[model samples]
Target: MARTGFDIVRSTNNRGGVDDFIPFEATMRAARAAGLPVGDYIDEVMNGTPGATQSTIDRLRALGVFAANPNTVLEIGPGSGRYLEKTLKECDPGRYEIYETAAPWADYLVDTFKVVAQPTSECSLAPTPDGSVDLVHAHKVFNTVTFLSASRYFFEMARVTRPGGRIVFDVMTETCLDAATMHAWATKGGPGHDSYPAAMPRQACVDLFETLGCSLEAGFQAPMGFASTEVLVFGKGS
Candidate 1:
């Protein structure tokens, strides 16, 4: 049977369970219905603050990631296309590619942004030769999958990212789970609880990236009420 976008969502949630599931449009609707600050919900909750993509680009410029004029960029799981929408207008990367799990979003990204979009199942950048991409990134992806799975993806990211290229991603950590509300929710097993399964210690994630031949450049914690996230940037080694 040909799979639909909702099928993809169902399968992903099955694999990662309740914790990893993210229904982007539904989330937005819920947020709007609740009268929450949509920007804050999208940024702090969904990951990647407003202007985050551009700010990262600027930071990359400072770090020499863009020593060359044209940059090839790849991002995994660019949910809701918020970052892409802003980045396409703000920065002129030589080429842009996205790996998105939700089929509807994948089509939307291609139609809306005119960027190459691949299914999340095709996680590795096969057509993109090794060490070709200037920047490889994923936002709010690590904690959604098992750490083991995320590590595998990082290995692929390392392979495709050029020497001196940049990588950015976010992870939920044990410290995030220690938040009182989060701990209680985890215990209660209520709806919207345990929405992240693969929380790791921040140091552990940094160590993994370091072992993958990347050097941590900067990182910060964004406090979401249920689960905080650590946004990290790294520079790949030759």
Candidate 2:
């Protein structure tokens, strides 16, 4: 059997192997090394906070993700439970389901947030019940995945979301992919340049949602001080 992207990432980092995978820390370091001023970016956009949780929350709100809040929300790849914490405190979802393939991080999140851990297939989002969740959110998860994997995840997100609910997520726009950053990542042998699969364009992402019976309400670059990121919000059509 072929190894999944998560498997390759985990295996490469273990047992004195190469770290060609794009973990959260390495990505942050690469961004900083590329002279993006990640700290200042986080502070200014995330209210001077140290993590991407608040920044994600603010971005979600800016995309009108919470317009139908107090509903169940599913977040894929909730690293360190920062987004989970913010959502619990702010979004107040009736139930928060997190899907993570990283075992250690998943364990930490489960312990810290006291939420259920749904089993996820390799390179795929877990099977969320149809029309069960009010909102689905993912942060930077799609950047590491292939276009096909992203399409599958988006379809799953649409399947789980209730009619009139929304899906909010972010990615590294083509403009955001700096050559200097890529060089650093290359030097580090990070997965940012791995052969997982090709990435889809921003317009293709919008088209995927629209074809799945969702309306793209908003899509734009999220300002993170020195760098710009892509954010998209989709509402399920009735």
Computed on alpha carbons, the lDDT of every model, listed in order, comes to 0.66, 0.64
Which residue pairs does candidate 2 place in steric collision?
20-191
Clashing pairs in 1: 19-195
Candidate 1 residue spans exceeding 4 A from truth? 1-14, 18-70, 175-195
Off by over 4 Å in 2: 1-52, 123-126, 175-198, 223-228
Across 1-238, the per-residue lDDT of candidate 1 in tens digits comes to 2233342234342234344435645665656876754444576455544445455556545655445543788888776665566555545787899876666666767886788875455345576678888888786667677666677787888888889888877777655665685666567544654545567677876887798888899876654434456778888887
Candidate 1: give its CA RMSD in angstroms: 5.4
- Candidate 2 weakest ten by summed lDDT: 11-20
lDDT of 2 by residue, 82-112 (tens): 5666677666676888887666666656776
Using TM-score as the measure, the top candidate is 1
Per-residue error for 63 in candidate 2, Å, reads: 3.8
- Name the top lDDT candidate: 1
lDDT of 1 at 231: 72
lDDT of 1 at 147: 60
Score every model by TM-score: 0.72, 0.70
